[model samples]
Target: MPEPVTLRPRGGMIIAAIALVIAAAALVFIAIDGGLLDLARWAWPVVLLGWGAWLLYLRPYVRVSEGFVEISNLVRTYRVPWGDIDSVDSRFALTIRTRGGRVIRAWAAPAPGARQALSTQRADVTHTPGDDDTRRPSDAEGTASGDAAGLVRRELERHRREGTAAVGQTALTWHPLLIAGTTALAAAAVVSLVLPHG
Candidate 1:
């Protein structure tokens, strides 16, 4: 068996904690400056509350071994055998379907270094033509058909068959909802702090 492949989400937990801290600090600054409370009556408090909730609830780790896949968030952990996986698919999220038909979705793939390590393991597996192991032909024709959906399908199939898949790098997702929500909350806190009250 190949060396155990461990794929962790990019960025140490420390970074995420730090980011939360920075965001919290910014909220504090906004509140003291009377900006948050002014932005919206209840927004800032809500944002802070949500942020805290996510930080407390979101456990973000994905680990794949020769025998099984392990996923954990701040709240729970799941372990599934490779053979139990029915299919893998990637859309807005990456999902693993089990023979029982239950689906587990991950926010994104593992990091680059982790992916590279997994790719190295692929060399030993008997990869079907349509299997994920088949690398895209470097020629133009392959590129033409290599659309996003195709890539996602290919990746899912690859991991399902060969027991490996690429992991996405860790970075700010830039999700609009999260950004807007955070902004709203921060603004509300500031406004509340600033308005004069008798």
Candidate 2:
């Protein structure tokens, strides 16, 4: 079997990390300057930054293995077998349509802009028809969605041709860490608002 393929947005992750650092610094500054009360007042913006970090850095990944494709898009992880995937679409993001008529979107691989998409198409045409491209085409990480989508579609086709369909159940798993973090943030915000200043 080939090595597992992981698809994620390279640029977004870096940007998110930078933003997270900046937000954390601001949080620390606020807490230090005026205590918890001042920090609490501006917590909403910090919370928004955290959510952005969660979306860009923590969540949204696609792992395509020989057996199945595991997609974690923010809150839930979807596991779908190769046989169940009808098609992989890249209209906005990487979306998978299952033979069972279920649609799953991958948050990690965002669709490229029009200019980037065009350049990718040009790149595809420039390659010799007979010469195979060694690199796995990706949409979110500087690679175009068209190439990434085509690669995935071809993989699915190859799996079908080889009769490699296994009995895999389509499952969705929630991210407990994300849920707990959100809950904690909300609780802190509420406590800050409700309790009188000491």
Taken over the whole model, the C-alpha lDDT of each candidate is 0.47, 0.70
lDDT of 2 by residue, 116-156 (tens): 65555435434421123432233333443544465566677
Task: Please give each candidate's TM-score.
Answer: 0.39, 0.73
Q: Across residues 36-98, which tens digit of lDDT does each residue of candidate 1 receive?
A: 544344445545754754543344555555555655544445666655666554333345676
Error of 2 at 146 (Å): 4.0
Cα lDDT for residue 27, model 2?
92
Candidate 2 residue runs with Cα over 4 Å from true position: 35-48, 118-141, 190-198
- List pairs with backbone clashes in candidate 2: none
State the weakest 10-residue window (summed lDDT) of model 1.
138-147
| Candidate achieving the largest lDDT | 2
Quote the positional error of residue 140 for candidate 1 in Å: 16
